[model samples]
Target: MTIIFITTFSEVHADLAIIAHPDYQGGELTREMVKELFLEEKLEFPSGHKAIPANHASGSPDRKAFFEYVLEMSETRHKRYWARKVSVGKKGAPKELASHKEVLDWIKNTPLGITYIEKTKVDDSVKVLLTVAVFDDL
Candidate 1:
């Protein structure tokens, strides 16, 4: 698992970008929760840079589209919206965020804080559900 930190609940959220899916844990992500969790305290969560689960993969035509749905918008409709922007050169294609290792280094020195929890699983085939609660920041 990975950790993402925010200083205050009211601030805007960073994109919950998926860097990779080496273990294939897929689900929905939202900025509002990330934003509110920042409420007047430091917050952290077990973040995974991966998809929700194969069982829920969107009907979208491509990997990028599927990811944006499951990981970013909580649905696939936005994939086409984001895709159009990419095609027009108004936006660059979204890269998978980065491996946990690269993200760890970035978080270490950055004012915005984060942590990495251990990777785990419950079933042999089902990866552990990514879960975490925040620590109040000093």
Candidate 2:
């Protein structure tokens, strides 16, 4: 009998760039701060403006990478976490959009919106807080 290995691994890794609206004056956030923002632990910027965290759609690879590397959770766990938060009356997960363009558009218009997107999709309209590499493994 012949045996063939069928592995399912991809070499396409992506870096997620954290971006905020151009009017954002809260300045850069540390990795921990970013984590707190995504985790819904922080709801406002240092400037006291409401921090609205946007996100690429649930199944987007960029979203997956951001959650894994930045937020440090799997998709299911992340959803559960947000669900629990929502049940308590806190804002749920970030607004999930379709594509990078959509995310960029939303961020550009939302003064307090923060999001992680592919570096290449970033433009001058948004302020880049930081760039984080999304590794395939924890």
Candidate 3:
């Protein structure tokens, strides 16, 4: 038998794009607005449509980058924040999807859906509200 080695490299940075459904009528979103939306602090878009925020699964690279760049919180802090909110029955965390493809598909069919994805995955299927450059190894 021969021995083989496998090497894995972590990403140095990932460019993420905050995207919404193509039909979403809201204007460009500020980081504050995106934070509020994702945290469930604000429930509606500027257009008065109900906002439905989606997230990548916990521990995902995109999720980690989003928390660092956009939300300005560490994963532990985010979990604590949401845990408190949920414990108090105030609100729950955003919908968690598995992959970029799933998020894209969901957002495309949902008028007020919003989520983040790798910048390279962005296309006409969704409208980008913000593009963040995340520099991290998480």
Q: For model 2, how does the per-residue alpha-carbon lDDT over 1-138 read when each residue is reduced to its tens digit?
A: 999997866554667799998878986688788889878788877777788898888799888888787888899998889889889898667788898889989999898898989887788889999988755632
On TM-score, the leading prediction is 3
* lDDT top scorer: 3
**Candidate 1, residue 51: CA error in Å?**
23
Model 3 quality (TM-score): 0.85
Query: TM-scores for all candidates?
Result: 0.26, 0.84, 0.85
**How accurate locally, in lDDT, is each candidate?**
0.32, 0.84, 0.87
In candidate 1, which residue ranges exceed 4 Å CA deviation? 1-30, 33-79, 93-95, 109-138
Weakest ten-residue segment in model 3 by summed lDDT: 6-15
Error of 1 at 113 (Å): 9.8
Better of 1 and 2 by TM-score: 2
- Candidate 3 residue-wise lDDT at 129: 90
Per-residue alpha-carbon lDDT of candidate 1 for residues 1-138, written as tens digits (9 for 90 to 100): 999986654332222232222343334334343322222111333343321111112342222332332333434444565567668765432223233344333333332232122222112322223233222224
Who is ahead in lDDT, 1 or 3?
A: 3
Query: What TM value does model 1 have?
Result: 0.26
